[model samples]
Target: MGIPRALLVLCIATAFLSLGPRGSLGRSHLHKRQQSHGRRGNGGHRLQSPVDSPADPPAAGTSTTVTPSNSSSDSSVFDVRSFGAVGDGVTDDTEAFRSAWRAACSVESATLSVPSDGVFMITSTIFPGPCQPGLVFQVDGVVMPPDGPQCWPKSDSKHQWLVFYQLEGMTLRGEGTIEGNGEDWWSLPCKPHRGPHGSTLPGSCDSPVLIRFFMSCNLTVRDLRIENSPQFHIKFDACEDVHIEGLSINSPAFSPNTDGVHIENTRSVTIYNSMISNGDDCISIGPGCSDVDIQNVTCGPGHGISIGSLGMHNSEACVSNVSVKNAVIRNSDNGVRIKTWQGGMGSVSDISFDTVYMENVRNCIIIDQYYCSNKGYCQNQSSAVYVSGVTYANIKGTYDVRSPPMHFACSDTLPCTNITMSEVELLPHEGELVDDPFCWNAYGVMRTVTIPPIPCLQDGQPESLQEIPNLGC
Candidate 1:
């Protein structure tokens, strides 16, 4: 008896499950039906079934097949050149995108394809709304932002850029790049003035993110290079079931608040097989997020993956069941950090960091319950964000500084608890561990194989006052 071709394809996909980056497992495979229709050829496009007409309900028992259509479709793919989009490598291609988007919406399983050449300038937002399932926004050219400040939209009612709102079953894939002409937006004159903690700046001038998705679901973004945004490169807010893989995001090292990936109030988000270098935290998971997993990511020259910096005034947030494993951090500010503002209300629990590698990072591991504002100013009100059940296992790293490799600062009011560390080893950059290993003024208990005596500072100062005290373990 011979195996059916569809069964053979399924077996092959299952075999590739563990071969690629950790995030690509289980979900990256093309649907067996899609493969049977036609083969995916050059340029990373997949042939997909025609999208069911809007009048029809989605295919039954076929919910898992909402992947994006490939670029090499026979007739449904939109060639940007046909719609007056000049690929001369210098013309503004924004209008070309608008035209292509408009045309793709009319067809079932259509692809808006941009061939590999030219720079397209996009000054306005392109809305691919009421997107049908199996629709793909494929880019093979560069999408560049307007050159200077004059081109950016002001915050007034007149200025509105790109946005993807209330769309379902969409896929954005490309081998090209999206560059935000950020200098113009970042240098706006009407920008907010500085405050005591840190100066307020202008809201991202609609040029902050090369791609923005809000209130979307079943979205997949893969195999692209996104660079140079005035703000966050990719931001997902209030979205669900989002999968991002095989992306390379690079930007200037000093770009302020240029977090590589920011997910707020989202669920079931997975990020894997990506390299992120940015000015702020490579990945910041904030309030109202759950079931988030990050694996096989490379991070360096950024703030590193962080949870919380949460509990802002009158805000209610919770982060749980988050896991990060098999990651590499090089010369980052901190590894596996959790921070919360004082006087805020939230709860972060059931978090785990496993098999993480750190090289020359500033702080190998940290949890700051008293995460004060800039300029080292502490809030008079204490934190209400409860931190508990954080575990660091199989962590091996080197700290570039002489201080204790591990630091935990819990609030005086709601102290952190149930913190555990196992098989954690840290090599100091300058000196050996200090003679004592205990927390300072922290309300929670510390458990380890050996609790060394707390080190006394030269001036008899409390542990909190001492900067980078030696951990004598």
Candidate 2:
């Protein structure tokens, strides 16, 4: 087999996330590629090969001056075009961008700019920091990576493409697009697509994450249009005081592993005024995350905003204080979900979703403690993540009748407690009304009447949770 169709997925507990094809965003479709893996046609744009460096300065007319707001007129602006970037669709502009970054990183409040009418193709790139504060990355034009897997840099980790490390007080905002030519990546057999292999296989399928902010702080990413990532679109890991605003992330409903906004092990986050549609979750808050507020989000044709698939591989994970409000989810698989695996230790609490509306979604609200990667049969284990203090209010939706609108399948040994629901009305979009909600070993109440009334929820805490044992959570 040429690539084993890249069969295999490994989430080491030890590891992290995946792409789904449950609705429009799953990697499970088994469609053969009509075009073989190769560099893409430039779509009327001329193509240029990568160069080691600029042998000469920019020809002219491509350079532009940039002045940061609230800064002196002398604030340095470094344009990539000035460093010999041919922003055609197929030029190797990686070195040009790096040189501009160096020049801008040296000075405080410097602006690194890209031309508004260019399509610069870069390779696997990392922008490391701890440099000058308030560095601005302005993307008024399109910045994209090499076309597909074969075009990817073999020496680089296939797990990640563009990465920013250890940056502080950096702002990345623009009116342009960061396009991921991900069609080839999504074709790998390992992606959760319809196939003989089912959804997930056990092994390694290393698809690159589009953009990652690692160990950075006080970062701002706003007003960007990102599309068709090979994997997770934007990830902030181990970052603090992060603000994401006015961003639109889009990928094909059938794209694999293309989560819109995924934040993990990060805190003090505010993701506001964003619209996400893809194959996976619109916004995924992963382990070690806290103090996250997501509002005014429009999510659809994907997995809904989720808090976890945490506590995998018997690992310890903790997530808390996440709030999602004033959101709309349409034609999605799951909405406002919390999923954790068995035999894991951790706690997920203080999460709330309020005033949200859904349309034609499969699962409007859910919590799955028996989450597994389908590696094999996950043996039922006693230990589980502690889930509590989750609230859902004013969530009205039309749903697909295949699954119940509300499913709270808490762990058998460690039942979920303090669950609250109010004014949630879910009805079938066109078919007959589905069954009542499915609840097991869950403790909660309804402050107001709900459609298909949930009489299955236990009114009091489960006796199994009376003396909660701390499993190093």
Candidate 3:
């Protein structure tokens, strides 16, 4: 006889519980509700607006509160030490957190508070639900990983270390750090390397992301510094109502696949007042995400903010309702980019980039449908995705190289359309702009750019000295 799917899932959950701290036997209770019918796979069903749900509102004159310092002002603040957790940074504090979270499950205004100047080593996942309103994971100190690889769970899953899944109305606040001692994990031996960088040699390295959130709602993470990640710094998947502010992510500039932040399959997310410096894209917005706003961000020595490289496998993947404004990028690969894979299906629309400052940029603006390939050598002849309804305004930047200040390469199949640009001026690096200042496939059109004289087309000019146009301005 074979075990049922739900039973199999339960067994996995139980196994995880056994690895938890002593006396912190957090049990998993399964309750089937009609709402479960709407959920899909890991890529769950898209969520409708909260107004469309039939849920009742909170009672009038009732509000939740959290008190971090044990003031007499709130009844909801709970010390994590009560659950046997020590925030000494050296102690294994995973179990204490589990107990605190479990106890908060029944409270309307519960908080799992962490005292200042201690390190809490986390080895397990922290799951918070809607009932735990005003739930705060206040980290005034560092939340560090266990010392060695042996202390971490030996698993093949992507989230082998620590992860947060399917929580609501939760906030992670602190003037602290989430540190991943990634030298061991990322330097592990793996095959068919899966990162922005190409395949690695045997016994080389495999980068794993530090933090990941899946299918969560109403989440806020503020005033935190995440450092030394193996792969992507942070990833949010299929989450809604997410806000991240005043966060700093720092990693080695040469770290492979260390994307600063990635938001995929989500909605209503805002990332603001953040500083990110990594090897890969500072921010990457994947498919099925919408209503994203990024502001007051400073990125450098990394790939700039991008939309797509989408339509990888499926026929439809939509990325819409995005705005990138009031940001600064310096010494980066490209300032603004939109890329899509060939032979996939989807559309990118309603996107806007405004008030961006770039300095010493290799390419001030670029839309490369032909991405992730050797220079000028793309695999597929046509692109699988569609890009349209994009606007770039008030872009002030400097180009470091003679490469084009702006380059747009749309797919021959689904050419880019409905694009507009205004007040986008690219100062010369050493010479003038390309005379034609435009290149387009048969299906697309290049409009709105003021052409300039093409320089370095002949004579002793190096191939790198050729000028590309700043079209659409």
Candidate 4:
């Protein structure tokens, strides 16, 4: 037997969701419900609106200049307009942008500039590079896709747009916007079914991710505004030494699969001082990612940060040395989470979530090993991913009254071990009483008394690992 075909195929298209986006009741209803349950005494604050900071990226079409750093010996600049790019949003700028990239990348320490007068309409394109040292790709105007899904070229793969491939020593920064113009794509009959009463047709989903960096290293992307992506907003795959900061990502809360930032097969990464609100995860850490540091992030109106749905379909996965601190997650589905599928083998270790504050969050801490999607059929499997050395410390929050504050549903065959939690306190946003935590096949110690307490956790791993008959992966 091999990995399940359902999991293997769906893993790429829908990584974080088993079901579609929940029908939003609006935050006002939740606030009133919480107030009715004596939530005023629970110390949970009201939900916050999207934040606008002074350091945020400038509006589109703002006048800005792209310049090389003082350390650069070569200060050549390549303007896209000089390469025959019409700044009007109607003309095709894909070839022009590519031409500019080639010229700037050929010269050492150069800057590729997008003028700030108008929108630059571009098709799905790749900017491949072994670019000159200290290269900068600066955007100072709006860059957008075609009008809608109807205008999309059938020849292009609907899986990706705006690819930055195989680049080194690059900085992509500016006060401009990369808009996906994805309103029509989200209304596809097979995509989450936003029709009458959420009805849908049975067909394939072919939504594209907005921006991606593949096989690149030593990159910096900062001070950019990204919006209305068809899928994951920004993805970094097989890249190293990536630094991202001062970004704002926004989308409707019902846009499916719009993870704010996703990293896979990447190392030595840092994401800080950002705001993300989408229909899916704010930050999703995938397989082969380690030495990651995330701090000073604000997330809401979506799924909070997550690690994995890793090792799906019996694939090998090993993730370690991740830390998240000084974060706020409010009015979201789940806070910090780790989810994996059954019958997969590998390990996730050395992770910590610290100093996280939550408001009206559902399932603030979770690890679900039997994660399945689309109500897919999954048979019992004996092999499991080993989850160990995870810690949740200084976590204080008010949770939605409907579900328990924490849930750990580990594999029965290979249970999660060495979990540690301390200074944890959770109360209902609407109720005076806190819900009890749910645990199964997980071993951990709590350094302090948690609200409602966790008594379902057993002392150690089960003594059996023998496989039963007819278990499929």
Model 2 Cα shift for residue 18 (angstroms): 62
Q: Residue 84 of candidate 3: its Cα lDDT?
A: 56
The reply for model 2, stretches above 4 Å from the true place, is 1-52, 55-75, 197-204
Candidate 2 local distance difference test against the native: 0.83
Q: Residue 28 in model 4: shift from native, Å?
A: 48
Stretches of candidate 3 off by over 4 Å are: 1-75, 124-130, 147-151, 155-160, 185-199, 202-206, 373-378, 381-383, 428-438, 442-473
> Model 3 — which ten-residue stretch has the worst lDDT?
30-39
Q: lDDT per residue, candidate 2, 202-271, as tens digits?
A: 4457889999999999999999889989999999999999999999999988887689999999999999
lDDT of 4 by residue, 229-274 (tens): 9889999999999999999999998888899999999999999999
TM-score for predicted model 2 compared with the true structure: 0.86
Listed in order, each prediction's TM-score against the native is 0.73, 0.86, 0.73, 0.81
- What is the lDDT of every predicted structure here? 0.66, 0.83, 0.66, 0.79
- When 3 and 4 are scored with TM-score, the better candidate is 4
Q: Number of clashing pairs, model 3? A: 8
Question: How many clashes in each structure?
Answer: 14, 13, 8, 1
lDDT of 2 at 189: 67
Give stretches of model 4 more than 4 Å off.
1-75, 193-200, 460-473
Please give the lDDT score at residue 369 for candidate 2. 96
TM-score of predicted model 4?
0.81
Q: lDDT at 405 for candidate 1?
A: 63
